[model samples]
Target: MYYIGIDLGTSAVKLLLMDEKGTVHKVVSKEYPICFPHPGWSEQSPEDWYAQSIEGIRELTADCEKEMVAGIGCGGQMHGLVALDDQDRVIRPAILWNDGRTAKQTEDLNQRIGKETLSKYTANIAFAGFTAPKLLWMREEEPENFARIEKIMLPKDYLSYCLSGVHCTDYSDASGTLLLDVEHKCWSREMLEICGVSEKQLPKLYESYEVVGTLKPELARGLGLSADVKIVAGAGDNAAAAVGTGTVGDGKCNISLGTSGTIFISSRKFGVDAHNALHSFAHADGHYHLMGCMLSAAACNKWWMEEILKTEDYAGEQAGIHKLGENQVFYLPYLMGERSPHNDPDARACFIGMSMDTGREEMTQAVLEGVAFALRDSLEVAKSLGIHLERTKICGGGAKSALWKRIIANVMNLKVDVIASEEGPGLGGAILAAVGCGEFADVEEAAAKLVRVVDTVEPEPELAAKYEERYAKFRKLYPALKETF
Candidate 1:
């Protein structure tokens, strides 16, 4: 049997086909426009996502026997607000996860409602990118639209509804919505009232591997598949990536350094940081995980290498960055404000401690080191909660860089294991589909068989000592600039 995995990303929808043995048969990607109505606001049409996904799926499985396709799953961008009217038509363009228009609303929730109370109800503090704050912003800014809202959904759940005719979301995705009682794995009534919405307005929640329903007959016909193809409730992007890397079970860690960076740690027992800096969310593997997210990761390098430096050769630029932790120059990777630990949206990126003799390689090294240091900030929070990580499985675009992986290993003082297949969430979704179809016994069993570590980057004692000193200084820079930022 074959399984299909749809990754509904911010810029495009990527479809993947994998057989029972975990061999990738084909992959297809379709792009769509991301609209910026204002300076900091990002939006996309739900219609665009559905159109592109349908077209991409047809292309992905063109050569396969369509009847052999047993199941479909999706791993998608989380926290985007998609509203529907009484007739089930899209009410407005989706407010994206990167959208920052809800700064005021986030502040209001943290202040007026109190962070302690909010965390008690939702196991998370309000953030500008969270769905509940965006809903609150919609209510205040567009009262007419708010009144017309018959249902509210996340980005991928909208696609799930279009395919399965079932309004449902997975636990990992719902954990970020600020409407879920994450510790209890249910909708929080207090949070529902605070957002001025009801439980009926929300989609039914499911575990990531649970089969939501079969694809709609019309959708199945259009895609040249049978109506019996099951659709599994997939996870949020980060959680899905964690599953793909086999970062399941207790004390396992996965670090993703994509456009945004995240440090995800899985735990058998529920745990929340004292500061609520790290997100305490239910994992797709039916356990719990704490995540620390940084808004900018490889993106800072992209900006420097492409926009500022006027070059597209990322590997060439990184070729000369041989010296690890001895560079004098330091950079703060906050290009798009920040999320985990600091949680300050006004924080700006900076290149500090640069000398007149600072070379191009030194500046490049600083960018890499800066991101590692910021990841360490979150690791410190996890440590405060007594979650000690000795090693982590690494994934994402930035994880492709050998130097970056080595730097991360030393800077965090943990072994960084490189997976054999690094397709992240999309591949994970396919694995979930395979499990849902009974090809595997359970998530952990499927992961243990599928996830392979090709190489391990061990932290050198000398390099780790140097990075420890540098990290101490890097941690102070944020506090020093906090008052001004």
Candidate 2:
């Protein structure tokens, strides 16, 4: 039997085919446009997601035996608000996860409603990216559209509803919406009241690997698949990536350096910090995990290498950077305004400590080290809780760089393991599909059997000591510059 994983990303929909044995057969991707109506607003058409997803699935399964396709699962950009009216038509464009138009709404929720009460109810403080703040923004700015909402769903849930004719979301995805009682794995009544919504407006929740519904007969035939194919409720992008990297069970960690960077620590027991800096959310493995996210990760490198440097040769630019924690220049990786550890939306990217002798190499090395140091800020919080981890699995586009791997390992004083398959959410969705079809016992078992580490990068004690001093200085720069920002 076969399974299909659909990754509904912010910019594109990617589809991949896998057999029950965990071998990938084919993969396809389709791109779409993102609209920026205002300076800080981001939106996308739900219709574009559905159309591209259908096309990508058709291409992904073109050569396979359509009758053998057993299930379909999707992992997508979390916290995007997708609303439908009474007739089930989309009310407006979806507000994306990176959209920052809800600053006022977020401040109101975190201050007036209070962070202590929010952490008690949802295990999280309100961020501008979360779905509830987007709802509040809609209610205050576009009350007419808010009044027409019959159902509220996340990005992937919209695709699942279109494919299976069932409005559903998984616990791992719902955790980021600021609507779920994450510790109890249910929708919070207080959150519903606070958002001016009822429980009926939300989609039914399921475990990440649980089967929600079967594909609609017409839809299955159009995509050249079986009507009996199961539809599994997949997770948020980060959680799905964690599953793909085998970062499940207690005391395990994975650092994802995708568009956004996250330090993900999986745990059997639920926990939240007093300050609510790290997010306590449900994992795809039916457990709990804490994550600290930076708004921009590899994106900073891309912006620097491609736009400022006027070259696409990332490796060529990085090849010139040989200084190890000795450069005088320093950079702040706040291109998109940081999230974790520092919830400042106005924090802009800048360079400091440059001299006349500071060449391109020094600045380039600072860009990489800056990201690593920022990630360490979150690790420092984890250490404060006395939950110590010596190493973490690394994935995403930035993880492909051996130089960055060494930098992160030494800077964080942890061994970094590189996995054999770095497919992230697409592969994890396929694994969830396999589990939903009864091919595996559960998410943990499936992950243990399918994921493998191909190599490891060990931290150098001498370099770790050097980065320790550099990190001390790096942490201070942000605080001093906050007033100026």
Cα lDDT listed for each candidate: 0.90, 0.91
Clashes of each: 0, 0
| Cand. 1 TM to true fold | 0.97
Query: Can you give the TM-score per candidate against the true fold?
Result: 0.97, 0.97
Q: 386 in model 2: Cα distance from truth in Å?
A: 1.1
lDDT of 1 by residue, 1-485 (tens): 99998888877888889888887888888999999898778899999999999998899878999999999889888889999998889999999887888999999999999999988998899988899999999999998999899899998889989999999999999999999999999999999898899898899999999999998999888889999999999999899899889998899999998778899999888877768899989998998999999988988888888888899888898998887889888899988688999888878789999888998889888999999999999999988888778999998879999999999999999999999877788888998899898999888998999888999999999999999999989999988998887
Give one digit per residue, the lDDT tens place, for model 2 in 1-485.
Answer: 98898888877888889887778888898999999898778899999999999889888888889999999888888999999999889999999988889999999999999999999999999998899999999999999999999999999999999999999999999999999999999999999999999999999999999999999999987877888999999989889889888999998999988878899999999999778899999999999999999888888898898889999888998898777979788899998677899988778889999999999999989999999999999999999998899999998779989999999999999999998777788888999999999999998899888888899999999889999999999999989999987
Q: Where does candidate 1 stray beyond 4 Å?
A: none
Query: Candidate 2 has which clashing residue pairs, if any?
Result: none
Lowest summed lDDT across 10 adjacent residues in model 1 is found at: 420-429
Q: For model 1, what is the C-alpha lDDT against the true structure?
A: 0.90
Residue 308, model 1, lDDT: 83
Residue 333 in model 2: shift from native, Å?
A: 1.2
Quote model 2's TM-score.
0.97
